[model samples]
Target: MTNKIDLDFLRVTHLRGPNIWTYRPVIEVVIDLGTLEEAPSDKIPGLYERLVAWLPGLVVHRCGVGEHGGFLERLREGTWAGHILEHVVLELQNLAGMKTGFGKTRGVGQHGIYKMAFRTRDEHVGRAALAAGRELLRAAIADLPFDLATHVEALRELVDEHCLGPSTAHIVEAATERRIPALRLTDGNLVQLGHGAAQRRIWTAETDRTSAIAESIASDKDLTKSMLAACGIPVPEGALVRSADEAWDEAQDIGLPVVLKPYDGNHGRGVSLNLVTEEDVRAAYELASRKGDSSSVIVERFITGDEHRILVVGKHVVAVARGESLWVVGDGVSDIIALVDSQINTDPRRGSGEDAPLNALAPQHGAEIILELQRQGLTAYSVPLAGQKVLIQPNGNVAHDVTDRIHPSVAHAAALAARVVGLDIAGVDLVCEDISRPLDEQRGAVIEVNASPGLLAHLKPAEGPPRPVGKAIIAHLFEDGEHGRIPLVGITGTLGTSLIARLVGCLVSLTGAQVGVASGQGLYLNQRQVAAGDCTGWDAGQRLLINRTLTTAVFESNARRILAEGLAYDKCQVGIVTDVEGAAGLAEFYIHDADGVASVVRTQVDVILPHGTAVLNAEIDAVAEMAALCDGQVIFYAADADHPRLLAQRAAGQRSVFVRDGAIVLGDGAHEQVLLALAALKPTTASWPTSVLAAVAAAWALDVEPTILAAGLRTFDAAATASKRA
Candidate 1:
């Protein structure tokens, strides 16, 4: 009809876990690039220049050539629209503040049909980026104007809405660095780290170990102060007052300069500092009382010094941030509000977003700022003379890192304050003349003990280097040498994988651990079927790993599942491959032979933990070839004890499981042990010698005792398991 190019999305799938593409969550979109399939970038006038001009970050995308400016090289040489779309989507996401680098595009055997995938932290954001990328690419191809800023802003809104907050993400990143798997428990910040019984849950800065009573005590400022005072930790003298009159009376009783705030408040909201007059104190009381559900306000002596926040994790002070009073130097033309906008809010670190280290200041919008202005005999509209200084905020922007300058005694007081309040992780707010000097020497005091404190200030400090507060919190949750992982086994193959998984599950359960099995037969938790009918995919595996009562887990996957959904867990203690035999239902995925199946099946071995083991069937040449792909130890299994691969594995000082006469044998190079007789196994396993050998190898890798392995095999009932699922 015309020379116009067009693209139609055929399908979009969110691969939530590892897949054939990679070991991360990716959004895969199948597109039909109608006429654009023939229109390579080099053939399209101004297309390459337009794209590079809009997304200059695309030059860093190594793409297929695997070097800087590789994507640009491909575009200049000649490339299809689908490949260009992949890079565009990734660049869009990067500009939207979610940095991800992995992407791929390939033809689907059809003339114009192609599949494109890119890594994303959130699926919703990924889909939004895809839609925007498609529109932008089409507009560029048609030589039409596209508003890149509007699209980037929309994608950024989606990122803020769907992605984890910076604090939670920092903690999750730390956990990932330690090889601890994390699962988001909610759409919000609630997340679970580790697997099954070893897992710990965190919501932002708070963890499962944070006590309800401790949080309650921290919320009540008066009680927290009293407790700190009693524990010999210096605390501000404060009293709760009910009415505005009572607030002034308490302030007078305390002294001329006083601090008034809500009895239970956070984030410095509804707080007035350094009040010397009854008018200011009474007005501050009304502002403070309106903040929280409480009507009472606290009147305390104003400790004259810079405000400081010390982060305490366990018994150690991990990070410290100092707050400086905000001031504006008048240029003689701008009012207070205009000055705040031009001087304070204009700082790149200040914004309304969670990623911003400091919040933008607006005197007109904040009650505390308005009250502070009133005390200074000024309002938001007041303009000072040139070079004259006006204090806009007296306190409460604790974002300059002072951790290295904090005195040891001050650090101890903060840690002790947190301990006194009974919080495993806390932010202790204090005021002192100098952080390098002790608090007692400067008449400084612990003003508040805050539970679930904000971590942004320490993580992205305005002045000093960012602190590892997230790592400190993670370390408090998990000790050294503990990754918060339980023993896990993953089985993948085309034959007898379900049975092997179930057998291994049963064997591990004999050690008094509650084992969960997700296999083709069904999903079993401690031998009880929780779900039935082919539970050998990512979702079922996730259920097992997330179950709080599960002490150990076994998962079964086939070549098809590996190609389609990826393994559920990140790594496993034992990965078993029975035989890479079948390619029957994989034609849809373009996998038509055992070699293709072998490549898919090797994903199981590829994910084995370095300290873990891979149990391979030495009988199958394809499966035996994957032993070298394992990052961990290998245990070859076969029906014949003298199988050459098994003998070689044994000679290499590795483990092997095989059948010798009528007995199952376990050998480690020079030593051999008869674990049990084949006659001792249940009748159901009599014709499943290979499956039995695979199961025995996996169980041995998991450190199941020889005696327990024998007993579990003798008692395992396939009929009962199937009936239970039924």
Candidate 2:
């Protein structure tokens, strides 16, 4: 066998939190480049040219040069296999329809081994991209034929199976725009926005606030109609029928030209409208009865009006969409189904997926369309006479926006119907001749109130401006200024992060808040260690943030953790960077100097919320320099109160903590408060004083009282012992 190029994946880790990568989940892959280590892109014959020809879109990757076409420039300039792999994987995921924009590749101590990380919206897609990227790169390097289309097709399939459906993604995008953090609770659309006690969960268009009782009521169409009618919302006069014969009898009683539908069916499935004959009524009932939870059908008076869907969110009308009846005019040569494909289904808005505003009309959808065609005395295979108009769909597909034109009274009735059905957010289906006229004037009535309604119609209307339904949903879920986040603290450094995190947790707990800590020692909850061993990584931090009982949390982030996985949380209320002693362990990540270590550790300060605070070690010049990078307030801690960095913060009328004589001094420019004597703090280690100072500053920034801080410092040892016992 000819020598084969190998890019062996030694390990793969899914970091499901903010890490050294961007502020999203990413996959960290450890790969041994093997023979490829000796072959940079420029050194290998035709490798760069072949890769460019395969994935020319990779030129958009800005890389370190920070502009378009930068990755290609780097490739042409002789970048190694690790960096190339990062770009290839990202491009593959992008081409597969799951767009991801952040990536990084760095040395991992071993000569040929490197760590590559890229943003991953879906774990399965990320893994597939990595595998495909490896094969594609190997093929390109060896001048072997690679099926790029097939590889991309497989990754696209994974994306469709694994990523969020469009409805949930829109809401999540709105939440993200509001700066509210989100975490996927499952492999599907179930997502939790915010963290801990402040979280609100959403599954597609439905929310945690969507009542189960209301959903049940909405699902029972007959009950919903009764409820709406009782509330004076003008529901259609309908009766639930148990059999096809009963359906015809009910239709006769409702009078000629009646509607037949499943009692519990949604999305217009198994519904047949405007049947004047007994035969048509019985056929419609047979079609409707087999679809819902119960085989029960509802027969109602058919109102002569277009159907309109009114979206109600929290007692107000948020959107309105008017349905247009679907019809296909037959040509001389085409059958009915073929005519539908060429005419009705040809609309750009019609599609088979949720992203499509209107669903594609196909005879295979069963019952409704087939029966409608039969009513017209034609089968799907029948090619009607030229110029013949065959009705394909009588209602549903409310794809035309009419929100601005809806009469105030009609809007009020729609909201009332939703309220009567007990839905916090609902879609109220009403049939009316003129949406701008009063419901009473048009003889219009609310026909159905649906729970967990599809938002696609309003989000992607065919003829009018798309509505901001996602914003309305978010507003209903959370109030103004509420992003669903609990107070959080992040402590990062080589020397004192673990101790500082522990002390900060202790101080926060004294406020009667349930506090969680992820430290070098273990993960602690309420001063009790729940998990043993090192718990300062991204996984450990995620545990604390995901816990519902945690009202406040503190996490320790070290250089190794930062380089390997990234910071666990997205942003923090208080970010503390203790002394950056040296670049000791960072040799693995290619950091040989203090500046390189500072850049890695500064990621902690980068995530401080604009309204939050960053606590820096003034004793270390590099740590103090990170203060300027913080988006929030800066508080410096030092052994000496007169240290230049501490004095600078004091001069700027900012907060600082330092030792003044034998006592810990809390200073705010020309003002100083003596909190506790250094002798009072029972030190656990040589670096204990600095840790104590950093923790106090961070707690103070979080608005903890000085007495609580003093009490926590004094009792720190017993708490440690208690944590160990637990």
What lDDT does the true structure give each of the candidates? 0.89, 0.86
- Model 1, runs deviating above 4 Å: 1-3, 108-110, 331-333, 383-388, 722-726
In model 2, the runs with Cα more than 4 Å from the true position are: 1-13, 28-88, 104-117, 137-145, 494-496, 581-588, 591-595, 682-687, 723-726
TM-score of candidate 2 on Cα atoms, chains taken together: 0.90
- Compute the lDDT of residue 313 as modeled in candidate 1: 93
Give the Å shift of residue 643 in candidate 1.
3.4
Enumerate residue pairs that collide in model 1.
none
TM-scores, one per candidate:
0.96, 0.90
lDDT score, residue 226, model 2? 81
Write one digit per residue (lDDT tens) for candidate 2, span 1-726. 135887898878887656655668899888898877888899888998899999999889999999999999999999998899999999999998788889999886778999888998888999999999999988888899999999998987888789988888889989998999988878889998999888889988788888999999999988988877777888778899899889888888889899988999998888888999988998998888887778899999999899999999998999999998888888778998899899978989888766788888887455788999999888889898899888888876688999999999999898888888788889989999999999898789888899888898888898899899888889999999999999999988877677787788888999999999999889889888888889987678878878988899998878777767778888899988876656866665567888888877888888999999999888888988887899999999988877888787888898999998888989988799999988887766323788788889999999999988888777777234544642
